[model samples]
Structure formats: C-alpha cells, structure tokens
Target: MKKKSLLVYGLSAMCLSFALPGPVAAVSNESCMECHSDDSLERDASTGHLASLFVDIEKFNASVHNFDEESCVGCHNAIEELDWDSDVPHPVDMPNPDCAECHDETVPAWAGSVHAEADITCYDCHNYHAPVQLAGRQTVAMMREAVWGKCHDAGASHDWLPQKEVHFRTGQCTVCHAPEDGSHVIFRLYDVTENRFLSCNEIMTGLQISGSFMANFDTDGDGVISPAEFQDFGEKLRERRFTTDIRAELN
Candidate 1:
C-alpha cells in the first residue's frame, strides 16, 4: 500500500508538469500549399512517402473538419498549396495542430487540458471520422487499430510521442500529466520505485497451496485461527512439523 501510494504521487506530479504548452510554434500549413499542389512539389513525394498506406486521402477527407480552412493543414503538415522553388524549400517541421486547433468549439472540454499540452495533438488521440475511438472508449476494433498503429507508427513518431500499446493500456502516457502543465513545453524526469515485500515465488507458492489470502490467520474465515493455527500454517508451508518448526532448524 505504501508503495502504491508513492507511485501514484510520482505519476501525478509528472503529469502536472506537462499540462502546459510551450510557446506555440510558428509553422503554418497554409503558406506551403501554395506551391505543393502544383503536382510537382517534390520528386520525392512518389518515392518518399507511403502516405497511401497509413492514411487514405479519401477517407481522411471525411473527417468533420477535413475541409475546414487551416484545420486540415494543421494536422497533416503536408502542404496542399505552395510556391516553393523546389530547389530551396522551407522545412515542414510542424503539421496541422491536430483537430484541437480547428474544432476548439467542439471539445472545449479537452482544450486547456494536459493531454492537449503534451502535444498529444488532435489526431494522436482522435481520428474522429473513421473507426478510431476517442481516448476513453475503445472497442475491439479500436484495440486492433491501436495495436496496428503501434506496429507502424512506433517507428515514425516523434521521440516524445507515445506510439506503443502498453503505454496506451496503462494510461501511462498521461499518468503524470495534468491538463494545466501542458500549456508550455517542459521535460521532467522522475525516479520511481515499486513495492516487493513478498517474492514472486512466495506469492505463487502460497496461493498454490492455500488457495486463500489467509495462510494460518484463518483469512478465509473458516473461524478460529490462533497462535498455534498461524504457526501450523507457517510450518506446513515450510515443510516441517508445526510445533518444532518455529524453533528454527536446517541451514
């Protein structure tokens, strides 16, 4: 119990730290599209991206905000229109701000939240139009999608992004975060420890033999477990005569 409490506190603190956003980056999706839609933005678009594999343009277009003016560009980062010289193009460091940027009116509940601050971004936790389930609701299909995304997005995601299933399941991604800390970018490393008062062998063996949490304490409520009863339980587990077992013996 003490161990669990500490873990909980540490996690809470960690989460509080990211509940804020760093200064919003200055990258714009609108400016780049001026040159990109020309059908010859880059020689690499064909060979460089497997965008067709992960997300379909047609399906993505169905998102509630797909056509929302700056909204779509915020999430995709890919320039739909641009006037790049092709020889010296600006880098695409920031994609769209995810759904949160465009649909602030809808999910105001999550806007000033730590999830938003951590750069969990709009699409990271939500792919609204399709089968993707929102954070708290996961169906069998959603689980499959999450696992599939785990398998693929794991390699491509930013270093700070969480693209793993275990992190998703345990809610560890937001474990230490609170919605407020994410207003700005901040990194905090925390030291954590787990309780292990009983060894695994002891837990397994005790459970295997007794089938109850009470070893001699009459924990199972059979009624009447005394000093002798406790010792008897201990000795039986230790493989010795109950009376003499507590006296100590073999090295």
Candidate 2:
C-alpha cells in the first residue's frame, strides 16, 4: 500500500493596527494579485467556512495602506514562494502583523476602551483590506453590518437593545453603546406626524432642501462637528421644530 500524505492548513488571524509601517516590502503586488484575484482560489477556514481568494482591486486601491503600494509580502511575510497548486501545507509560522504596528497613536484610546476589555481588535470595527473613507450614516451602516455577523445578532441578543426595533433602525450600536467619553450627541429629525424618522431623502422630498443635511453639522469641512457647531445645529433644529432625539456618537 502507498503511504498517504496528511493535509494540514493554517488559519491567518491578527488584530489590525492603524498607520503602522509595514514590513520591508519585496514582492510586486501584481505577482500576488495574479493568484489572489482568482475567484476559484479558496481555503477552508477552521470555522467551517470556505473563504474566497478574490480581493477587490478597486477597493484595495482605496485602502488606507494600499499595501503600501509595494507588495503583499508586507503583510504576509512567511511565504517562501507562491505555489497556487502545491500539496505542501501553508507555512504555519506566517507572520500576522497587528494594526498597532502602524497606528500606535490610537493605541491608548483603544486600550482604555470597552472593546479592549473584550479583546476587540481594530479590525473588529474597521476593514483591513478595503478601507474606504466613510462618514455619518455610512459609518453607522458599516457597524450595523459588522455587528450582525461578526459580533452578535441584534434581534436575537440582549433584549434586542433599548428602544428595540425603533432604536436599531434609527442609530448605530456604537452611537449609544460605546464608552461615554469623547461622545457627541446627534439628533435625527423625527416626523411626529408620520411617527417615523425622516431620512435625508425624505427630508429632501418633503422640505425641498437643496443640499445634504449631513453637511450642516459637518460645517467648516472638518468632517466632524465641534461642540459649538453641535449647539448651533441644535438651535437650528429647534427653530425649525423638526422634533428630534439625541443619539450618542463616540468621538
């Protein structure tokens, strides 16, 4: 009888750090993309899921690091050679870099955060591969999407959160659940007549507002509201009698 070869696989897992310099880049991104771009390329994760090998090049381009525009080897530092079809087990010692390697500045904030106590990594809330510039509801949407699969099922867990269904749809989990320090309270207009929160689209349709209301708070083009701006915005809402409630946002 011929001896059979045993197959083993290594799972890559690491907490992502921000703004950290990557390892000395050596390989071309093209070489790595050549194989990684294949949709057929997949590996069985220890969690019983088949992970796809496809990486969106467009999104990668938008990524904060863009793999430092150098090589995939910057992050995956253990590959001796690329063998798309080798029976050899993946090098188990592959170095999995952390986000802290680049983003030491945010480490203190993160360390003191509630997430840190729960062992949540930067990658828990942020995407390491497709780091897009997001704002306002976009960030909230991302958090909601992540919470469903990566964290917990909103409907199935913890009394389904305060205000139940209404709150879930109105605000991001972090808006209320994140630590109170450095938090900002944002008020979304509620349509008392309709018994619903007015979406930006609805507000535009109903009131014929010319520009995005999001810009109102993000005045000065800073992408975030200061205390003074927040106060002014609240005054404007009151003047308009928009009828709103506060949603806490971590700063």
Candidate 3:
C-alpha cells in the first residue's frame, strides 16, 4: 500500500510539472548589442550604400531610455520574428517604432507643432539611441545645437532682429519662430562678473541654501516665484556678496 501511495505521488508531481508554464525566450538589449556594438557592423542599403548598424553601447546606456527595463524588442518588434541564423538578420526596411506608444500625450501636441507642418519628424532632430532629456534651458540649447547650423542658419536668418545673438542666447527658438506654441518667462541667475549664467550648483553654494534652490525661492510653496519671493531672493544674493542678478527670458 505504501508503494502504491508513492507511485501516485510521483504521477501527481509529473502532472504538475507538465501543467506549469515554461520560460519564454525574450531577447535582451545585451543580445542585440553583441553585433550592433561592433563598429564594423554595416549592411548594404537599397541605395547601394553601406548603412552603419553600429550602436554606441556607452551612449545608449547613458540615454534616458537605458533604464534596463525596456528591451530592444520594445522598439523593434519585427526583429523578434526574424530568423537570427540567416545571413541577413534584418529586413530590407524596418519601420520606425511608433513613439506614440509611450509618448501618447506628447504626440498630439507635436503633431500640431510648426515642426510637423514643416514635415520635420522626431527622428530628424532627435537621436533615438542617445536622446537628450530636454529640461528648462535645455530646450533652447538643444534647438540651437541641433537645428541652427544643420538646418537653419540662425545668425543669417534672424538678421532683421537687432542683437539677434543675445536674443538667441537668452530665449528659446520656438518662442519667436513657433509663436503658435506660446511662451513663458524663465528666470535664470546671471553673474555680471563672469558674464555667464550661474548653474544651480553654483547658486546653491553661493546662497548657502541646503535644500532645493527653487523651493527656497518659492516661499509660498506655490511652485512659482511670486514678486515678493523674487525680491527676497535678490536680497539673499546681495547679503551673500554674490554679484548675481536674476534675468527673465521668454521660453
């Protein structure tokens, strides 16, 4: 009877094992990087030109999307169905990923933007693998860096505007160029002595502020700097003997 009981237990265990789901084979970024990381990796394009397949792993890892959470298949879903053993691992033309999948809220705004009317795409200005995370003044800086020389000559194009260089430095391109988008004032601490903008770290050190610099200025805790708060901030800078002035620019 004990032998029969043991046999029944063994059969039940076997059935349980069969019922359990097996591990799915999911391709990771590392697997794609094995070949793509190689600088020599290139493929023949339909135009008879050699298109580079190389992906700078270091740059990609540093990008905002490199949280190790999303896989390469997340963007290139077609790659999952490809036969890796084949001589040509990639299709002749792999469609660009639908950025709206993640940026659903942003797509509608972008679609209505002046850039869309000009037929400019997200890929045109942005590098997918190593995109810059634009915040505050970074929006102006990135537009200047990416678009100024490559697409539009800012110096020559804005010749009609007096002190165009100063305007370009202090304001966002979209504020003037894409007026339909609207604009807001961004206050920055400028050092008259250095003739340059003071970074947040520099301001924190100069003011001897321990917590968030913005929070320190936003006295009413309203997230925005009121006129009273701005005046107080200027006083604090004066007290510290820091030759700094808060300059406002339309962004």
Candidate 4:
C-alpha cells in the first residue's frame, strides 16, 4: 500500500511539472529585425494603405532611442514573441503605442496644436524608430519635408509673408503659424559650397566632435549658447576649411 501511494505521488508531481509553462525568453531587437529588416515586409491597414514594416537597423542605431533592445518592445508591447510557424507573430489588432506615455509634457502642447485638431498623430510626422530630435533648424526642416507637397503648399498658403521663398528656406513654420508657442533664435552654420544649411550630423563630421554638437559648443556648460560661444563655434568650423556662415533664425 505504501509503494502504491509513492507511485501515485510521483505521477501527480510529473503532471504538475507538465501543466506549468516554462519561462519565455524576452524578445530581442534582433528577433524583430529578422522579419522587419526585409524591405518588402508590408501589411494592409484598415484604411486600405499598405503599411511598411521595414526597419532600417543602421538608422535605428543612430537614433536617440538606441539605448536598448527593449526600446522596441517598450513602444510595441503587443509583440511578445516571435512565432516561426506563423506568418504574423502578433495579433492583427495590436494598438499603436501611446506617445503621451513618454512625452507627457510635449503631448499636452501638441494636443492643442492645429496638427492635432486636423487629426495629425505623432506617428504621422515622426518616424518611430528614427525620430528626429527637436533641435531648431533640423526640426523645422523635418516638418517641412514631411508636410510640404503632401499636405501643404507653403508658397500658396503663405502669400502674405514677405520673401516667402526665403522664409520657407530659413524660418520655421511654427514661429508665425503657431503663435501660441514661444520663440527662440537658433544659430546654424550655412555651407556656401553646398548652398545649404549644415545639418547637426554634417557639423559634427566637419568638427570631428565625438558627442552632441550642443555640448561641444556650450563651452561654459550653461545649457545656453552665448554670443561668444556661437562665434567660437563658427571660428572652429572655418578653421576646418568649411566655407560657412552663421545664420540665425527664430524658431
């Protein structure tokens, strides 16, 4: 009778082991990249648009969100694991990430903006993986590239503004358009050889700076670029044989 009881206990223990699920390994960015890296990877959205699922790993690495692999899952929580047998790993109705979760301060201001009123979402203008940082000229340039010709014609819409062409080139849309927002002047390097403004990336490459352009320029570490600092930065660029001019614009 004792031997029979031992056998029954062993059987129950075996059953319990089988019933419990083993730990699932946390999803890595590599796992997501396996499929998303494919340029042809696309899905049909409810709006009848073919939404591309392609993620450029290089650009993502360079982006501000390159902190960890979990960054992907942080935003896209629905994709828990990769199912090799299935064509679609995640649920079809997986919701978009709430931008307000991280951008609590910015979202409140954006919510009141004309873009929000027009049903423009953060995803509409901003790329999830390679989001453009809200620096002065770069931010304005990104906004212009995103909406111009697609949603707005600057020339036709801003006929009232003087030197509309120059404004479109040098000025930010938000300064005049978004009057509710405060304005600030940003000094940028204009490349005479390129006949265009030097991007942060270009400036960094030109100066051979290792970290942030702002950090390099803010000599006093005051979090604000003074007139002396701006002049010094321009001088450094000129020393590098870059035929550049400092252009200041309200943004």
Q: List the lowest-lDDT window of 10 residues for candidate 2.
A: 5-14
lDDT of 3 by residue, 1-251 (tens): 99999999999999999999777677788778878888999988777999888989887777767764556788787775445787766575788777798879878988988779998787677777776555565444457785445777777777887667677677786665665667777779888998999988888988887889777888678887776887898888889998877777765
Tens digit of lDDT per residue, candidate 1, span 1-251? Answer: 99999999999988988896556444453444444444434333434763321333444465444544334345555534443566545444444444544556746766667556775555454554332324553432455464345433533453564444433443322223433323222212121222224443554464365445454357557665555676555655456321221221111
The parts of candidate 1 lying over 4 Å away from their true place are 1-55, 67-81, 88-98, 105-108, 111-119, 127-140, 143-251
Candidate 4 per-residue C-alpha lDDT over 116-176 given as tens digits, one digit per residue, 9 for 90 to 100: 8999898877787886445545444456775444667766777886567776676776675
- Show where candidate 2 strays beyond 4 Å: 1-25, 44-53, 67-71, 78-92, 112-120, 136-139, 146-150, 155-172, 186-251
lDDT of 2 at 153: 66
Q: TM-score each candidate.
A: 0.27, 0.48, 0.62, 0.60
Q: What is the lDDT of residue 175 in candidate 3?
A: 68
| Segments of candidate 3 deviating more than 4 angstroms | 1-21, 45-49, 81-84, 88-93, 139-141, 146-149, 184-248
**Pick by lDDT: 1 or 4, better one:** 4
Q: Please report how far candidate 2 places residue 61 from its true position, in Å.
A: 2.7
| Residue 135 in candidate 2, Cα distance off native in Å | 3.0
Q: Candidate 3: lDDT of 230?
A: 76
The positional error of residue 139 in candidate 1, measured at the CA in angstroms, is 2.8
* Cα-lDDT of candidate 2: 0.61
Worst 10 residues of 4 by lDDT: 132-141
Against the correct fold, how does model 2 do in TM-score? 0.48
